[model samples]
Target: MPIGPQPHGRRGTVEEPYTPLNLRLVLAAFGLVVCVGLSILLFRMGWTVPGWLLAGWAVVALVDIVVIQFRRRARARAEGGDHSLFE
Candidate 1:
């Protein structure tokens, strides 16, 4: 397929392999796992304060992802309303 203006139609994006949103979600999930796992390991190894601190960082990343996705949607809605960009 040519990388022109419209790479896809209205529906059937989930079946597509290179969807941008899916890629972002995968990266975010990986980051969450790494942060949360490190936090658990620290807590188990007799580190109380640092473990909790690492957990807090993980929480921050989660919140950041939510906020960023929300803003992205809102901005897309405002700019000429091209819903196809989301899909």
Candidate 2:
């Protein structure tokens, strides 16, 4: 009774917004590029350990990009047409 807004107390019904897969793909791609570039720079600077770690992360980003691509293709097919990624 002392609050301006009352909590729903676990009975609140909230709908989650749809995730943007295209944006995820783009971000993953950007991450991969940055990780790879930084890894190379670190290696040239003789920071072997961090360089290897960044390289590993770059591989993970690459895999994520591939997985996102597959998901995008499946979603497009399920939607009955091949829509552009930006759409």
Candidate 3:
């Protein structure tokens, strides 16, 4: 099928095989980097000895798990496998 702009003021997007998985992965990685950097800065400045780095790592890990699950479900649904994406 032709993947192009939709009519009206609606956002343009493909129906399938072109979900935002790649974009989500990129954003998640960027968030992880920012979290670690901020944490280090705060620690070095003596403003707080909080677990900034650790917190950032945790956020990245959590998001990774969620993204993986979402992609898996999408694939399963598209393939008409013996599983429901909503389930």
* Candidate 2 collision pairs: none
Model 3 CA RMSD to the hidden true structure, in angstroms: 9.8
Those runs of model 1 whose alpha carbons end farther than 4 Å from true positions after fitting are 1-30, 79-87
The 10-residue segment with the lowest total lDDT in model 3: 1-10
Error of 2 at 84 (Å): 6.8
Would you list the clashing residue pairs of candidate 3?
A: none
Quote model 2's TM-score. Answer: 0.73
> Which is better, 1 or 3, measured by TM-score?
1
Stretch of 10 with least lDDT, candidate 2: 1-10
lDDT at 81 for candidate 1?
48
lDDT string for model 2 (57-76, tens) is: 99999998877777676666
The C-alpha local distance difference test score for the whole of candidate 2 amounts to 0.73
* Reference-based lDDT, residue 33, model 1: 80
lDDT at position 22, candidate 2 = 78
How many steric clashes between backbone atoms does each model show? Answer: 0, 0, 0
lDDT of 1 by residue, 1-87 (tens): 322222334333666444344345456667778889999999999998998998988897787567556644654554434434344
Scored by TM-score, the top model is: 2
Number of the top-ranking candidate, with lDDT as the measure: 2
> How does each model score on TM-score?
0.52, 0.73, 0.44
